[model samples]
Target chain A: MKYEILEHTADLKIKAYGKSLEELFMNAARGLMSVMYEEESSKEGKEVSDVVLETSGPDKEALLVNWLSDILLESDTRNVYCFDFSIHTINEQKISSTMKCIKSVAKEDVKAITYHGLTIKKHNGKLEATILVDV
Target chain B: MFSKEILQKVQKNIWEIPKSYREDMCVPARVFASERMLDDITTDRSLEQLVNVSTLPGIQEFAISMPDIHEGYGFPIGGVAALSVEDGVISPGGVGYDINCGVRLLKSKKTVKDIESSIVDLANQVQRDTPSGVGRGGELVLSQDEMDELLEGGVPWIIKKGYGLEGDEEFLEQGGRFDEADSSLITDHAKKRGRDQVGTLGAGNHFVEVQKVHEVLDDEIAQTFGLFKDQIVVMIHTGSRGLGHQVCTDYLRVMVQAMAKYDITLPDRELASVPFLSKEGQEYFKAMNAAANFGFCNRQVLTHLVRGSWKQIIDKKEDLSILYDVGHNMAKRETHDGKEVVVHRKGATRAFGPGHPEIPKQYQSVGQPVIIPGSMGTFSYVLAGTNESMKQSFGSTCHGAGRRMSRKKAKKVIDYNKLKQELDEYHVVARAGSARGLVEEAPGAYKDIDDVVNVVQETGIAKKVVKLKPLVVVKG
Candidate 1:
């Protein structure tokens, strides 16, 4: 999968294209974490039990926010890295997914998820997601 | 759009964007800015954000932005808007992520000359005593029960614990406590995030600077705040730390649902809000107040820690006291526009006029103290509110030397060693856990605070009391 970061804002932006929903969601989460955490310092660890999330937004932009919000919410609340997620459903208004959290107490933490560059669109027949994380 | 094309000049230093900007907009967007800063910042998304903010339900006559405005999440960093309490909307975006992140100023009887030789020792003491940087915890750890009380009691609780002075509380805005805070509205997770974070100087633009009162512009107001020329003072800039951030994030999820429940339609989802009288809105206010109180309490506790550092570093028996504490990112139920409105000021400080009920009796003749910190190694400001600000910005003023360069950009352009050398030349003793942090916060990365303060002072929004030059800096 490959992604592009849009110009600038306090919140980060990334457009990821992948062959599978799991790959795309994983890349998107990775993109958001890079802004708050020193990505160079992150480590892969023992995987925790799988957790599923389901949320429905009124539109794709809201859907993307809900998707990422669920991942981040899980991280802060659970105190673990939500390393990956596989989307079972991706629609304009709803999503269902199974996510894996790196089950370790983390040294890094995200302060908040910002509403900067928060939008979802399709470009060149590929899904694009841009979101902001407030650290 | 924040296009001045739609704005009508009602008077000097005030511009209005009518309600016609959008159908959902409850009122116009009012801006408090110099013609120059307005022109410079409005070209970006900040103005559009202001207009979007104006569209929030129950927003009063206008949404407003301060002179030191910049693009931010939902509201402009220096944005202010009040919603009719009975009908207006409440938004987490309006208060920002850091919650009650604010500034507290403390004055010392000693002159700058008296402590000139001990600058390094004082800074080292502060860094050692005051918790700072990412993932740091301070000496104060509130149990679940204590945090609940702290949320409601605010600075008074801190003072009770021997953190501040009786005179200090009398001078604080709202006596440094937000009364509406409902502990029930805060989640266990949020309380946990904040529990160990009290007295901490969080990362990013957060700082604690020991400064000297270099100039006093208003003798009466300066005297009211116990500020004197050459007097040494310290400014602690921080907020509810991790807890507030968690609260805002927690509420944003609920707000998104609230928008749909209220059938509120908006151009941006980030502008999600619920009518102020709605259950969700009231809960947000309660929770936000709790967070704001947490922020207030956090600063209060920090004041105590700093006092400890000062007494030990300089002289154990020397007297040290607080001047004023002000919240920057907060929402309050206040009277404005001849009505009760819920005003949300994110990255803007409340500057209530002298006689406002919120200000304590001791400052009835001088208004609230508004401490605007400069970037590291720069001059800080002390301004007093004017009735004009009360009439104009829901009693608010510019918060700080708004950033001109991104931290990433600053780190690239400002060499850490050179910046340190330049600061040393100014006799600004400094200590930081990270050299990278020093570079990211280079004074060159921000607008000249002198310029920002002059505009606010000249506009009569707030009168300058004194200017503070850094004596020593401690970063976290």
Candidate 2:
């Protein structure tokens, strides 16, 4: 399983898993998109706009937040909904990726990606992370 | 992570975790909640977050959490902290993502009986006229110059544009504008998101509800505030929308990076902040004020929309007039106990007592009106600030019923159809853009507002003036 939505009292939480760090980030992005839209159905044959995002953070966790935040900003500015992501390169300090988004309305406003109870760790020989998004 | 063993009950409805509870805490943490409410409050990390807030530099007295306190990113929702401006800090998280997320009450001469037959039509009309739901922009699209003026002038600019009525400024908090707001400090991206969002109500708990005065707790105060039993009122709850969110997102990044430069360390990245006097801090303050202005203007335009909607169905003589508007999420410079401090109220309302010069001239003899919106299908309230509030909670009070269950849990347990049926049984009409949204906001998901209000009144923070029951709810 790539991701699972978890119960939170006041926000949206997702637990995503991947065999590799890149896959973990990809799954996390998919999880966020899923929360913002109907991920599976919205992805069918829609016109896509490809854009690159580059950002640096102090660590992997911060980088993940920055990466997702950049995408959120782009989504708001371009008035589009992102459905897919490809992480070309990612490290402790920086990341570069191409996002595939379609022009569509968001189902809900994901105000910001929160750092509360945020952790990206490896367990049982697989990478896993739990993220909280303030809605 | 906080245990009940560590909390000392200070009084009947108050709990305290002293400064000694944590080594990093600069002050104590005080919580106002009933015994029953405390049980639910202890189920989450809200107390832990309150302790974290107490660690901020220059916090005075205590890091206080209201009866409606809930877990949030940095400070718990319904949290209030007064930080000394001389050497304290300003954290965006403290004011929340939605700057100036607030409540405004408009009283109408028409009573529930007068509009009983038209409640459903009024609900539908409001939902249609006021742009709501997710990603829905209002009809007003502003140019850069116009956006700048609106950001700086707030309700006055909107009124000049013919979206609001004259003399409306007197009924708003801060006169609906912050003179310190600087449009230049706000980012282009933030402006882009805000340009077309004015007068729009975004999703997630933001709403326009038509209500009736169910009971008058204090007849004199109620009469003074122009509220009578069974009288109709309109309540609008929203914020600066995408603009405020972006401003917070943008500044959190800046403060996070600047933390190293200033050699400041925090327990949580969400608490990232700079000294109030720092250049970055001032810039954020100005930008936040500008966004707050956007929120004020946004609600003002919606007020105009509501007035227009009401006029179509009700008589012209039954005009709607502003009772009061208050910002629940904000950080403002104020004096407390002879010291200047920056007060941050997140999911909390300011309730300045009588004789405060900041209050309107008409209400100078009484206190500021405190509008506490209940959860959907629940009983709301109109209260007045007290001098005891000024002494105890920095003139702050609870903002709402507070959520007992998460949205996910609400969706799991509440059938949308059944929920709608229940609202119908209560004669409370509800209209929403999405059924799922309505399910997520089921009234069962929230705490008993009566219990919450009782705690506030018993604690002497605010005095109850009137009780309001929702007659119609229009949501995003």
Residues B207-285, candidate 1, lDDT per residue (tens digit)?
A: 8899999998888888888889999998989888777887887787788866877788876766678888888888988
Off by over 4 Å in 1: A1-11, A19-21, A40-60, A73-109, B1-12, B18-24, B161-168
Clashes in model 2: which pairs? none
| TM-score of the second chain, cand. 2 | 0.99
lDDT of each: 0.77, 0.91
What are the per-candidate TM-scores when only chain A is compared?
0.71, 0.91
Error in Å for residue B202 of model 1: 1.0
- TM-score of every model? 0.92, 0.98
C-alpha positional error of residue B44 in candidate 1 after TM-score superposition, expressed in Å: 1.8
lDDT of 2 by residue, B302-346 (tens): 999999999987765555899999999999999999999999999
Segments in model 2 whose C-alpha atoms lie over 4 Å from true places? A42-46
TM-score of model 1 relative to the true fold?
A: 0.92
Query: Which ten contiguous residues of candidate 2 chain B have the minimum total lDDT?
Result: B311-320
lDDT of predicted model 2: 0.91
